[model samples]
Target: MTDNTQHTAQHWVATDYGDLDVLRLEETDVPAPAEGEVTIDVRAAGMNPADYKHIARSGDRDALPVAIGYEVAGVISALGPNTQIASGAGAVGDEVLAFRVAGGYASSITVPARDVFAKPAGLSFPEAANLLLAGTTASEMLHVTGVARGDTVLVHGASGAVGVSLLQQARLIGARVIGTAGEKSVDTVRRFDGIPVAYGEGLQDRVRDLAPEGIAAALDCVGTDEAVDVSLALVEDRDRIVTIAAFDRAEQEGIRVIGGAMPASATYRDGVRAHLIRLAGDGDLVVPMAGTYPLADALQALELLTSGHPGGKLALLP
Candidate 1:
């Protein structure tokens, strides 16, 4: 087992919901696990677009001083009493990954055993850190859309983490995949075995030419109005179209949406988490992390995220 005390820990706290300037790096007390929980000495943390969106736009300043990260990959440090995680697959010192209910920006976090998963043997800490939120969201979309053999799937923002994941998972289900991205990311979408199409102006023509017969289902990982418009144009049924972004607008457009902070039921989250673990272990999933920033430089990481077009997921290493 590694010596847990020899390491120093740091956390990023956002004093108020604003820009990257709002985040502060501070030396905080290390966390301890409660029963049914395990404390992880965080090695890496993954950033999502929602992290910045929530900080800038969510307007609920009541949760000020909130830690700002959602996914982490680390080593098991301490475990709470009566926790199976302490004795099961992950004992003290085992490498692990977890999706936080909150507080993942810290150098250490206490996560419920159910929300933690054993990191796959060949995956690095940074790679595993990129999986949780985007991977699970993609899994859920596939399930909800009932994508099946011979179906033609269309994914918007195919160069992004969720879009790439959707492309791969849809392929695994025996579906033909076509994805939209900027012209520069066309190669990346093609690398994922998806037919690549450009995402602006003439998007409808590009998608129609690629799918030919029809697109059985569509997933919008990018919330652009163009993405929504193209999906509605190609798919005959609005129910078969889903958006991870544009939740408020999806309702108005009559398209199905998922994963906004709108009180998602526990059952749904559990099912999605299960699918993620299965796909990761079976070699059916891939999470591309665009870049990494030192934990102390979280502000820079947020800056990169806010700049947009990261090309993939962004992460922080402690």
Candidate 2:
């Protein structure tokens, strides 16, 4: 057996806050599991825009040498002392998916047991790793807006990951969704059971034509001024208009904001995590895979995600 106390693993670290150039690979000692924690042999790491945005937006005063990545899928290698349970929340050798880890862009990581869940057998490691964050964010937005059966809601940036999840979840909730996307993504939106409305000039008119009675709610994932304005014009209740991207305007315009940085996002995600997993496992919800890259090529993937909407989720094989 390997010496547990001396095992080493490689991880990606941001040497500084600027761009993808800041990322560097380095070998480090594997962390031991603490109480309520588990050591995972990471097989896949999901990449999202938030991974890079968090670094780019950090000020000079922020510390350097920060570890990057937040979501992963893997097998449990060890469990924390006193964490054994009759429920078997996370046992050694169990394949699992986890989120909000300190540094997921690694071959191995130690995370709180609460953050781990059994990865559904139906999903590959990449798909399971890509599921939670976007799914929960979409679910939380719908929850806060009180979307329900027979309601018609507008979704901005409907071709992106979170947007796709929102469209699927809204349909599962029995709500009608009118999603906005570029011409290239119109078909994608339609395939997911959303009414595809091309975004650009006259978007408001187009959406109005589709929903003559006005929308029941609006979700802005793009944060474009046009998106917020159109949503404001059509959705009568400011409380029903939520933006996952436009926090500044959401504050000024009295609309709700639900993003990772938002205080309430944690509670929402925790409550909905298991439900999202079940839905994905049952094929009631699907996360489209745009691309996959080896761990060493993560910077390229992040660059692509940062460039613009990539139409789906990206995964890093560790």
Candidate 3:
């Protein structure tokens, strides 16, 4: 920040709203953080499907060339006057992680200090960068569904990032989880202590075979009708079923849907950041990373993400 004009950064942006082909790796001036903000020298950027989803959905020319990526783990390169991070005071050279940030797919990012947090020593940069978004989402699903100790919950797409988080967090809450995964992902579900049931035509019967005691709630991380139909059939209490993606299905079926885009969900997710990060620090929660790619290979990473079998979370090492 000593010489504001001298700082520059390489970042990913969607010059137009479309597919991955429209994205460009471009250089831009790194602005000095304004009051209550700080600039970070990013070490890693977390990858999520949401990152690419935004790029193709803006549908507005004015919002063209929007920055991509939402979270990062990095070092504080500069601090604004009187800036304080989400956890407390921040300092230059402090290792940190930030969520709800723009342009995180970069070598550096300047973001609001309010979104920055002290990175846990137990988490590597890749893990720290990938924690908050999915972790918070999973936490909210469990919270809204009234998942409690001794409760058995069914999670669709159990091997996904959010599902993995749900399994770990639910374990901490003393709730037993029955998770649905592909044959290849069965071990991953089991690794997280979830009863792994292979998902397909016989998913419901398979789930019933594992949890004959009855499922107390259902979490739909996958948007398939099978997820919705099975959840509706198993959990008579519609209030106990929730989906993060199937908005229309939720409306039709009267099941709940939660995401960062919803006001209540956003508030809850933000409020839980401190607690979730602490859990990661204490090793009560583990972020399973399937892969990491160079910053410039964000598209390739996105391709794997789009493949719907990433195995776990993905991160971009900058």
Candidate 4:
């Protein structure tokens, strides 16, 4: 499975969309790429809340039996005839990472060439796998909110995967970030260069004290009512408040929302993907791994991810 070869790949399949109980390890034929596609021998895959949320809601649907991972990092195994990307200088067998696709839980995946980018030479497969979707989401959130240098930004759930990514990107743009996390995660937020405020009662007060100049913008990775309420209280303009989670209420509250069922425009998606790959390549992004599970133990992995409060991304190894 580690070497690039055309062979049957075993994948974890969710026979019915429900809880982790529905996920099963099953053997399936390895997929081949159509024109403008490349096949990957998946070395590592990243897991997120969206994986289980989609499974729970997709009950009895035909896509029910679909493969359930969105991000993977691996070596190119094969390329379809029309994939000119592999023919250019420094192409094919290039280690790469990709996002916004299915079938990443398997030993191999067929992805459109345009959806993939050459993995940074410095990152391990697991590290590269961790960056794709979460990094892109963070990038898009910062872009949409127009967060800029010298601005003070408040972020909720600041120690989670997306939160950490957002903190790093916001700092890169020269913003001073004040983030919320459980008391135990304060050190983690501090390590990321964010001012850590314990999340709970008095969150708004803590943020106000941390940034006496006032919060110019807010990004919520945590969808709790507390998170939404605090952001509304601190930022002067609702347009500067963005929630990656609370899209349903964003419009009513006048906060900007990005990355949910609200489809990302192609231009924004491309820009975010490029920034993520570049950050990984430049060593400016760090994706901590909470744990790793064998492909056979995928259900256990999903259970841990859905359990909530895990500090970093859960990875699947084949």
Candidate 5:
């Protein structure tokens, strides 16, 4: 009898940047762990716009056949040499979730041990896979802007995955959040402890009415010009205004931008992953799931993400 775990694995890859047609499913040998790495039998993979956007934005990149994925949750199947150190190494059968990994859209993956964390009991595999990126981004946004207890902040796209995380994490920090959302999503933002304000013309005045003292900080998850303009007018200090979506305008407007694509921004997100995992496991943070798809149908998942307003995060189940 042969070990099925060592058999070929199926995964999605982008040979070049293009539309949904660019994503192709392929089979390859199951990966073996190198030093300080662990192989996981993936149960769930999280989907985000960044996954597709990263490919679409690349122009004639040298790397061909790039494995496309960022986050996954699964059980450890094997550990690499010298990985057992200080009782921190993940053992076989350990349920774990990891972020910032390549080739996550597969039945199994080998990732660095340092990037893996024990899956929080309070969350299912899908939620655990979804937790790290948005949660850490929210945490970093709050930290970089100095949002504290008794402070009021503005969050654009409050009902989005990252926006919802922002609302929950900001409330956890004891800050009051005034969030911009569509008319239909007002209650969704409110449910996350955010005061929802409709996004449209006169958004600045509406936010001002809600926060008479003015917002201490503003975070734009939507990356709209309106959001940036409103944030600039309301916040006294430009440093307190940040955009995760509008990186190009950040320098021109003299406001900070935190994005995974930016070299300087990774430190803020990487530093907070462990703390975010703890918070989610403790039930202080929640990651809402919009939908889940079989691994082979990842094209539909990417299409749904690009469609916008899916109401929550999408996950891939192998």
Candidate 6:
């Protein structure tokens, strides 16, 4: 067994507030898990636009050296006394996935065990790592909008990570999804049982044509002027429309907007993690894999993530 007391890990950090150039990889000591914590030898780290977005928008100079990445899947290397995983009891060597943790873009990480749950055996490390972040976001979006069986949801940016998860999750609950995507992602939309609608010119009219009875809710994953305009035009009930993006438009237009940074959103997302884990483990929900990148190539992976055509979920293999 590897010595648990000593671990030298390579992790990525942003030394300043800027773009990818601010990201610097440096070797650091992995401290042993403290009270109510666990140390993980990370096999895979989930990548999202938020990973880079947070860094790019960092105006706080004091928080300059914040670590990157939010979720990871790996084996527990060490655990604090009297601590238990969120799913229940756990031990060193147990395979687990953690979300909403910091510094996950590393070969190893020590995080509060409360947020960690056992990785489903059916899922690969990367898939498990990719599961909760987007799943929970999709869940929150649907929850806020009160999406239910037989209801129709209008999803903007249905081909992306959150979008794909939204499509599948909505499908599982018997809600029909009319998803907006580029011409290339029509198959991606259909594969997840979503009705594909191409974005751009005539988007509003096309969505109207697809759901003439009217959209039950509009979930905006991509914050585009077009999405906001179309959603406003189609959905009569303002409170039923929500956005994870389009924060400014949501404010100006009096629509709902939620993000991980918000306390209420964080609480809701955390509360639903176990459910999402169960869904993925039971094979009811499948996270579409876009691709993986080496730990050293975080920038490249993030570049693809920001490209707006990631195809599906992306991960960093540590």
lDDT top scorer: 3
Output the better candidate (4/5) by lDDT.
5
- Candidate 5 segments exceeding 4 Å error: 1-6, 84-87
- Model 1: residues >4 Å from true position, as ranges? 1-8, 86-88
After superposition, the stretches of candidate 2 with alpha carbons farther than 4 Å from their true spots are: 1-6, 60-62, 84-87
Name the TM-score of candidate 5.
Answer: 0.95
TM-score of predicted structure 2? 0.95
Residue range 1-318, candidate 2, lDDT tens digits: 112453689899888888889899899788687777788899999888788878886666566788888899998898878774212555678889998777889999878888888888899899988998888889988999999999999999999998999999999899999999988898899999999998999999999999987799999999999999999999999999999889888888999888876668887787788888889889998889988999988878887888786768899898
lDDT of 3 by residue, 1-318 (tens): 332543889999999888899989999888988888889999999998889887767677887789999999999999887778999988889999999898899998889999999999999999999999999999999999999999999999989999999999999999999998888998999999999988889888888888889999999999999999999989979999999989899999889999887899989999999999999999999998898999989989999998889988899998
| lDDT per residue (tens digit) for residues 1-318 in model 5 | 112345578889998887778888999787677777778899999998888887786765778777888999998888877684112656888889988789899998877878888887778999988998888788888888999999999999999998999999888889999999998888899899899999999999999999998899999998989999999999999999989888777878989888886666687777778888888889988998888999999998887788778889999999
RMSD of each: 2.7, 2.0, 1.3, 2.8, 2.4, 1.6
Between candidates 1 and 2, the TM-score winner: 2
What is the lDDT of every predicted structure here?
0.79, 0.86, 0.92, 0.80, 0.86, 0.91
lDDT of 5 at 23: 83
Q: For model 2, which pairs clash?
A: none
lDDT of 1 by residue, 202-228 (tens): 989988888788999999998889989
lDDT of 4: 0.80
Give the per-residue lDDT digits (tens) of candidate 4, residues 177-238: 99898888888899889999888888888788889999998899978888889888888888
Clashes of each: 0, 0, 0, 1, 0, 0
Q: Residues 174-276, candidate 6, lDDT per residue (tens digit)?
A: 9999999888999999999999999989998898888887899999999998999999999989998899889899999999999999999999999999999
Worst 10 residues of 3 by lDDT: 1-10
Off by over 4 Å in 3: 1-6
